[model samples]
Target chain A: MIALRIGLAALFLMIAVTVQTSVLTNVAVAGVTCDLTLIVVIALALSRGPEWGAIAGFMGGLLLDVVPPADHTAGRWALSLAIAGYIAGLIRRETSGSPVGPLGVALTVVLGTAVSFFIYSATGSLLHDPSVDWGEFGVRLGIAAGYDVVGAIVVIPLVMWIMGRVQPARERRRVAP
Target chain B: MLKDLGSPSRSTSSRSTAPRSAFRSAGEAPLRSAGTSRDVRRRRTVLLLVVLACFTLIVLDARRSAGSPVEPLREAAAGVFGPLESTATSARQPVDNLRDRFAEMDRLKAENEKLKKDNEDLTRELTTSDYARNRAQELDKLLKVAPAYTMTPARVIGIGSAQTFSHTVTIDAGTADGVHTDMTVLNGTGLVGRVVRTTQGTATVLLIGDRNSTVGGRLNASMALGFVSGRGEVGGTLDYKLIDPKARPKVGDRIVTWGSSGNAPYVPGVPIGVVTSVTANEGSLGSTATVKPYVDPTRIDTVGVVTGPPARAPRPQLTGKGN
Candidate 1:
């Protein structure tokens, strides 16, 4: 069952990466595209707990870093997403087992995306990448977080539903609430 | 062992002391599976190790070059994911066509207006002088020189920016199709970019609109040499820095590639853009101007890679003004 869950998460992440690169790239609003992979990482982290979240986040981030047309450093996304997943998992622990409202979910996704983009840019500047211009960071961060919030509304529930389906019946009951 | 037991008990007590009575009052839902203290410790350790590994990889890949160790890993990933991207792109073609059709009318209207204006200007120049006719023919021949080069056409299969923060596209031609790093890629309109990385079946093209990209440019009117750098936005203006401090560049001047050492990255005489604006301050290092590129980097669907330059160079033509 654990293996099945891992497999499910990996499959979902790969699809998210492909779709994000090919499809979502054309659906830009304000020149910023939504990040489906990041949302998927957060969803898995919230469902499975911190350790699982970090591992899944690392894998997803690594894929983003190495995927075709990705010319950035190899581990920048991995570092950012892993940290994002860990924090999101901590949020899950803090609000353990309690049903969160739509507002709570939106807030979490926004904060998570904002923090992740921040870390990515911060590390980029530290690494001396000329692309990380701080002058545009604030506006880009706002647009990226806003776009991701819209994606999370549709993606988070779908991921949770799939996660519940792959679990045993007894575990499903625990996950359904 | 005793100390470990004490710490776990203390941590568990601290965990239970949180204000959870309100949540528990509603109903008991096993949202979280209970884990032993060892599990918590192990999870934290795992998180630490993963983060450390990422840091190490980042530092190692910070200065990527032609022969970096990360190149193999990047190529391997491209080989694995290239097929998936191509499939997804092909499957989405119908939807893409619908979107394109909606914008087609406006684009065609704009193109018609521009062509009509050009026709009027050419007719007037033709009647004015034989020199104008010769210059026009020279411009035509320069453009015709493109077919002389060996070219490979490819379709764009993916658009990506989430990871790199730069504008880039994945094309469905790679080493298998004679596409390689530093090859010049262009569309029907004008310059697109150069290939940066390639797998067996796919290649990554770094668009000229990326902030990190810099291309040598020559002013069409004044023949002044300069460097053009992207402003980091698709369809945004490019920054051109003149090489000669004494050379004065004006707005409305055209630009083209100055040609690289072997023309591997950029071939000579490829049109880049027209100057849109110029800065007032003329520093010791020459003036700067903004250029509006001929090709809209965002809207390109297909591009051709120049595998080889023309066998012989075209004779340099003179403008009506003496060189």
Candidate 2:
């Protein structure tokens, strides 16, 4: 059962990473692209709990870091994903079913995006270019939040269904001769 | 009840052993059970490692102050995705072709009408005052100020991916076509940007209206100089410390590049934009004016890189100075 869960998580992470870097990036409305990988990590964390969530987030983030445009160093994404996963897991434990689960995922996505922007801007400021314009930053934040929320709505339920299939059956027993 | 009390110590010991047994079983459980706390811990550790990696990269990238090593990765990604982009572009080609046909037909009709009007205007000019002829001669002289600074035409290719910075655009001309870093890119009306990055056949231009873009410009009528800085949306703000607070810069006043020193980055007299609005703060020393850029960056299909003439040699110092 444990092995099966790990495999499922690994497979989901890979798909999320590939889709984010390739397809979702091209699906921008206005100038904002959806962060699909972030949504997947948050959804998984909310559904299956934190430990798995953090693991999935770490792997997803690592893959994103290594992918195209190679803007930042490797560890930046790793840390951000870990924090996002941990936060989502905490929210899951505190929330209940139905709308709350999806809501939690949405909130996690927003929080994760905010943290990313803040960290990236602070880094840019330290780097001296200081490209962070307050007005533009606020607009971009709203756009990113909107994209993530929409992504969460679609990804959460789909992920939940997949998780249901991978979950172990407690009632199954071994047959003896 | 008796059975329960009789095995109280045994029960407690068994209870303690239960968690240990569960932990041991977790190690051998099938994949479905992998969501256990132990595995979660491992994942969290990995996440931390990834974040740390990104942080290190940001720091190093900022410190280098030069081009990023990420270029190769960007190029590779562009290469892999190039085919997909081409396919998407191809799919829209038919619609584009139709649009082009309609546009060409409209342009031809406009030209026909313009020629008819020009013939009438020329007839009037011949019978009227000689002012039109004098104006033409002056225009010819004005156009002859620098005959050497011709233009090398190029096409727009792609835009940058990052949303925070939209001031950059990619062009098909590069060093091979005399497009160098800091070389000015212009359209028919005015300056667009300066080339920043270049490859064998491509270059990235930083537009004047980007938040990071700034240029030295002067009002054509007043010769009042100021530095124009981008406000990030579609316009730029001009700043000059010497300007008065109540300075009234009317709309439609042309602005032009105020050349830097001999090694100035941009050529002088390249039209930038017209003053759109002017406002003065009550206590501020200088007035602020908004200038709408001359070139519409979004619709730019073609551009030219200006390779201006070499600097003039300094005149020799006078040997016979007055005593």
Candidate 3:
């Protein structure tokens, strides 16, 4: 059963990455597109726990860092996403008694995105990546975080609902505070 | 689930043998809202291990200059996801075309009216300039702007951003199709980018708009050499800096490739863009200009990779257009 859950999470992440790279490329608003894979990892972390969150984040981020058209360093996304997932999972644990509301999810998504983008650019600059322009960092951060928060509202609940269907009935009841 | 959690026999025997078993016992607690101290310790350990692994990868990837150890991993990922991306792109293309058509309708109507007026003016100019001297000048302009090259055409399968800092596109061509790293990619309009990485079935083209991309270019009129670098936006103007400090670059000046040695990365005589504005250098030295590229890197659907440069230089044309 654990294997099945892990496999399902991996599959969901792959699909999210595929959709983000191929379909969402055309749907950019103001030259910024939301990070769908990051949201999926957050949703998985929120549904499961910190351990699963870190695992999924690492895997999804590795895929993002190495997938076709990937020109950046290999572990930048991995590091950012792992940290994001860990924090998000911690948030879930803290709010266990009360179901995390939509507003909370949106807020978490925004914070997670900003944190991850910060880590990515921070590491990028450290590595001397020429793409990290300091002048546009603030603007990119605002646009990316805002766009991801908007995407999270629609994506996070849907992922949790799908995960709930496959979960054992006892665990499902326990998960809902 | 209950057997793994409740069974004391399994946990006690395997607990000493493997840390993972201890993780399964404590970390996999499904029903417990509050985990034990052991569970928290195990979770922290897992986080630490994962973080350590990520840092290792980062250090390895960052230190490598050329021919990275991560190349095989990147290739494997591209091989696995390339077809999936292509499939998704094909499935989405029809819907995308419909949306584009709807969005293009109003813009096209205005353009059609303007084109008709421009066509009439051009027809009148064509008749008036139908002389031998004018014909030679037009032919010279064409020769100066264009040179023959063998190229392989490919369609863009995916676009990459958000995760990567650079703007790039995946084309459905690869080493199997003579696509390789550092090869120039262009469209009908002008230079698009250069191939940066390639898998068996797909190639990643780093678009000219990426801030990391810098191409050697020359002024078309005076042949002053310079470099054109991207401004990190999809439709942003390129920054052109003259190599010679005293070189004068005026607005509306055209630029072309100053071809790399062996023509590996960029070939000679490919049209780049036109100078939109000029900025004076801080000191009494080099000139700088903002150039609007002929190709819209964001909207490129089909592009050609230059396979080989022309065998010979362009010759003078004695024939007229009609003849």
Candidate 4:
């Protein structure tokens, strides 16, 4: 059952990455875009718990880094995402009766955005690109974060509903017998 | 049937066993001990993974030329989820189609009205003056000296995700259309970019304005040579040594490609841009200039790929005294 969930998550993650590359990128909102893959990672983390979330985040981030025409180092994304996942998982553990619905999603999206932007900023500073001005960084970060939050609000519930329906009831029956 | 045979004995043994409290205490002690160790180990593992990821990024980025082995893993992930991507795209196609239909109608109406007015204006202008004829003659002369390069038109399919550092565009032409790595791409007016990667039927072009993009260019009128490097924005900077500090380059001077060393990549004489501004510093030996690219990359629909040797080669050195 664990393997099945991982496989399903991986499949969805791939879809998210491809769509992000091909379609969602073209649909920009005020010169900013929603990172759909990030939304997927957060969703998986929330639904499947922490360990799986971190793994999914790492893989998804690597996929995003490799597919895009990026100027930064490769593993920058991998590390950022792993940290995001771990943090999200920890948050999940701490919150109680946290209505696993819209409120939960909003929190996850906001935190994920913050973590991604912070990691990128640190990495850029280290790289010494003179264009890494704080003002521009703040604006871009806000745009990305806003878009991601919107994506999470819309996508998380729909994914949860789908997973709930498709979950393998047969496994529970096998264990009982 | 095997479960049924063992079930009776299991129940009987449970009834005959020592009190539940005795077993419970023993179980609790070990469970608590094991849980703490497991938690510690898990935390250690997570920390180790984070450290490794950061270390790898730093080491790889410090290299003069770096490309990560993680690319294959990314590709594999994409391949695995290709089907889901298609489904999502298809799901959104209906709405897109509806929006496009209305937009197309509006565009056609505007185009028709503009064309009708243009025809009347052209007819009146042609009768009144020889301006069109003179312009055509000049254009003909220019064409003879430097013929327009061959082109393979392409449609932009995608743009880069991270807009902070560089700008990239993906086009619908690739190796199948005779496109190759590092081939110069140009729109009607000037250079656009070079092909970075190619699949069977699609290619990604790294735009000239991308932070990493650099091209050898020269001023058309003065023949002043310089290297044009992207400023991580809409414009590029010309870095060149001027023999005279007073060599003031005026605005609107054309910039053209100086070509490559051996011409395996870019062909020469492709228009790059026009000088928008120039600044000279007394402390510095050379001046810096800004270039406004002729092609508005945001609206580029069709582009030409220049193929062949560079227009000029390095001058050969005389062996002894001048003949």
Candidate 5:
């Protein structure tokens, strides 16, 4: 059962990463791409809790790091994504009722993306990457956070619904459902 | 695999040994809290180890270069994901086409109006300037003497990838297609960028509108030499220092690449942009202005990479008699 969930998470993450690198890139708003992979990691964390979230974030981040046309250090994304997962997982199963879970998911999405970009940029500067555009970085950060928040609305419930199907029936009864 | 590492069935057990409220309020507190002390310890331990592993891997990979042992894994993954990405992008092409059609028509109309005005200006100038005609005639011969380049066209696959924090476009060409770093990339209208990084099947082109980009430029009207660099905006900004700081560049002045060392990163005389505004600044350089680039860097489809020395770019219409 665990393997099945992990497999599902990995497959969805794969699709998310591919779309992120190819499709979302061209559909940028204010020069910011929708981080589909980040949203996936957040959704997965909310369903599976902190530990799994970290592991999933690691794999997703590693894939992003190795993907073609990436300009930064390989581990840069790995570290950021891992952190995002951990942060998001902090709220895993913590909220109850209708609005709370969704609010938690929304918060996770916004905070996760913002932290990931902050880490990426801060690390790049620390590494002396001159190509870092400090001027537009602030605006890009805002757009990235806001973009993920919008995507989380649909993605979070979908992931939770899928995870609900896979979990043991007694485990499902513990939550609001 | 991971769930089995911890006792999953007992955590969800309806056994009398567990408290109901622990699961009721928190949704699964017993998964962490109801378990034995060692179980909680182990769960936290696993979390720490996973995060630590990522951090350690990050440290190691950041130190490694493109030829790291993990390079093959990345390549293999790309081999799979690249095709999926291509298919998805193509499927969405028609939707993008429909959405952009009206906007594109408006742009084309504006461009047509500009071209008509330019054509009239050129005809009037050609009739009046004999010296300009002779100079152009001589320059055309000089262009003939320059090296002829072979161009391999490629389609741009992605623009402004979120994973990549740079002003670059990923093209469908790479080393396999003879594209290399520093090769000039251009579209039909004008300069786009130069190839920065290439893998087996794709290359990243760094656009001239990036803040990091620096191109030497010459004005067609005033003949003033300057450097143009990206302003981190929709267009680029031009800077002319040292030479003719006193002469203020006017609006609508055409600018072209003044050439680069051996014409590797940038070739000579490629159209960069037209001056849009010149603002006075209290400094030795005196003034600066915005430039409307010839190519729309945001929406490019087909592009060419100059694998060899490109042919000389023709001069624009000569300015009025001066200096």
Candidate 6:
């Protein structure tokens, strides 16, 4: 079950990150690319709770950080995404049956995006980069958050279905009753 | 149906890891979230390790002097992603061209660069033409100035730039053309070196830019005497130690050869070069300046050799051009 889940997560991460870095770079809206990797991480987090979610987020974020055309400090994204993913898991743990409404997915996406951007900008400022153009940065973040929210509705359910298909027999038996 | 749709989002259909005993305790909550303290501790440790690993990577990248260890990873990613990006762009080109006149900005940028390069080439051509026209007038003036000494025009077959160490050239005019060793050489503007060696058909003329060569020189404005010698590179220098301490030669001063005895090696009143930089002498009690030569040794193509004695046939009266 663990192997199957990990394999599926790895595949999804590769597709999401590759598309986010390569394809989405050109198709920009208001100078912001849709962070599909962030959406995938959110979906994985919602599907799996804190521990696995944090693991998935760390690995996914690390890939994003190391890939080519990466301009910022390495590990900045890793830290932000890991925390965001963990928070997402914690949200699932706090809520019963983890609900399916678009409202919930949208909130998680916005909140996750906000957390990631906040950490990224804060880390940049701390590292002596004077990222003082709040107006432009804020607009991009806002657009990205909105973009992620829209992606969440489709992503969350899709990821859940895939997870169900790949569920281990032992776990499936345990949950069947 | 809505219940199934809503509950399935939690991925409850996936096999649960929790025991049935814990399942009743947790009711509908996911099993991983309701873990023992051991699970909590393990999760904390993994999270901490991930953060620590990330922090280490950040520090490693920041301290990267030339290239980071992860550079290969980035290269591999680029190798993978670059072609993918290219493929996507190519695929989109047709659809893109159909809408909004695709790649307008790209075409404009290319056109801008081409226009900029064209403008630069045109400007360079105009400058070259202006230089050629002015050089023609200077050569014409030379004929009127020194009419007594017969001038043998020889094409500069080889330039000093072809040689690594010495500023010397082989001219087409040599012994066959009445050229010999020690004949004074000049071009449209000023002093080229005298003939150093001559073969059956070609001669090598030493230029003032040669370190072994020096010319007895006089400043045009102050009549101050100094020796101009080559640095064996491009320009020569005017020795200031010989000049009187009271006299100061300013920048842009003209230097002309103060003719050798009987005008054997170099003729008199021939312009050598112009002063470009003046600096206080480090060890001596005077100022020294660099002179950019009138004839660029590397660019010489056509030259004249004085085959005989100084122009004693009634010196041409000094005119609008300098003596």
Best by DockQ: 1
Worst 10 residues of 1 chain A by lDDT: A92-101
Worst 10 residues of 1 chain B by lDDT: B313-322
Estimate, for each residue in B54-141, the C-alpha lDDT of model 4 and write its tens digit: 5685566546355556545434433443334334444455754565666855754555344334433533343233322434543343
Predicted model with the maximum TM-score: 1
* Candidate 2 ranges with C-alpha deviation above 4 Å: A1-105, A151-177, B1-37, B66-94, B97-142, B145-166, B172-178, B200-202, B234-248, B259-265, B281-284, B296-302, B307-323
Model 3 TM-score on a 0 to 1 scale: 0.82
DockQ of 2: 0.22
Q: Rank the candidates by TM-score, best first.
A: 1, 3, 5, 4, 2, 6
Task: Please give the lDDT score for candidate 3.
Answer: 0.76
Better of 1 and 3 by TM-score: 1
lDDT of 1 by residue, B201-313 (tens): 99999888888899999887766789999988646569998888778778887787877766779977667888998885544556789999988876777677888667654
Task: Give me the displacement of residue B174 in model 5, in angstroms.
Answer: 1.6
lDDT of 3 at A35: 92
Query: Candidate 3, residue B298: CA error in Å?
Result: 1.5
Q: Per-residue lDDT tens digits of candidate 2, residues A5-119?
A: 7787777776665555434544555545576677777777776666666667776765555443233343445545656765676555444222344555667789877765555
Which segments of model 4 are wrong by more than 4 Å? A29-31, A100-104, A124-135, A164-177, B1-40, B50-54, B57-150, B198-202, B234-245, B300-302, B307-323
Backbone collision count in every prediction?
A: 0, 33, 0, 0, 0, 3
User: B305, model 4: CA deviation in Å?
Assistant: 3.5
Question: What is each candidate's fraction of native interface contacts (fnat)?
Answer: 0.65, 0.24, 0.72, 0.26, 0.46, 0.25
**Per-model TM against the reference:** 0.83, 0.61, 0.82, 0.70, 0.76, 0.49
CAPRI grade, predicted model 1: medium
What is candidate 3's lDDT per residue for A39-109, written digit by digit as tens?
A: 99999988886777777888888888899877888998898888788778766766653567888898889
Screening candidate 3 with a backbone cut-off below 3 angstroms (N, C-alpha, C), the clashing residue pairs are none
lDDT-wise, the better of 2 and 3 is: 3
Residue pairs with backbone atoms closer than 3 Å in model 6 (clashes): A171-B15, A171-B16, A172-B15
| TM-score (chain B) of candidate 2 | 0.64
